[model samples]
Target: TRKVRRNFVAEKYAVLIDALYGGRASQYIETQVSYEDGRTNKVAAELRIEDAETFPPGAVKQAA
Candidate 1:
């Protein structure tokens, strides 16, 4: 399916995922957002984490 299967597989890229979840959810993010009117404005948002599920130990082999 060309997917890395985030559950068990993403741990292979632990450092990168760690950086994403590094701090509190209430942290603010700032970036530039462009509008259709050809004008851009700074945007900010509060980062948050969401829940996900993982496959059972033997379940991963189902694809094979």
Candidate 2:
């Protein structure tokens, strides 16, 4: 999180966002991320997605 990207949410966490509604077993993958100490490390994980409860349609109001 040191070498911060402007749009890191979409770049990094898009998978989790997509899988939030539907469950998935993602394949193992590696990514190079920077640290606060200016050091870089290889981050690896096999992400497991779990389904989440959602509100009923039209249950929540949209933000203006």
Q: Specify the highest-TM-score model's number.
A: 2
Which pairs, if any, clash in model 2?
none
Question: Cα deviation of 63 in candidate 2 (Å)?
Answer: 27
**Colliding residue pairs in candidate 1:** none
lDDT of 1 by residue, 25-58 (tens): 4445566788999999997676565555898787
Question: For candidate 2, lDDT tens digit of each residue in 1-64?
Answer: 4786758867787666666645555545578899999999998888765556899999999899
TM-score of each: 0.41, 0.45
lDDT of each: 0.64, 0.72
In candidate 1 the C-alpha lDDT for residue 24 amounts to: 38
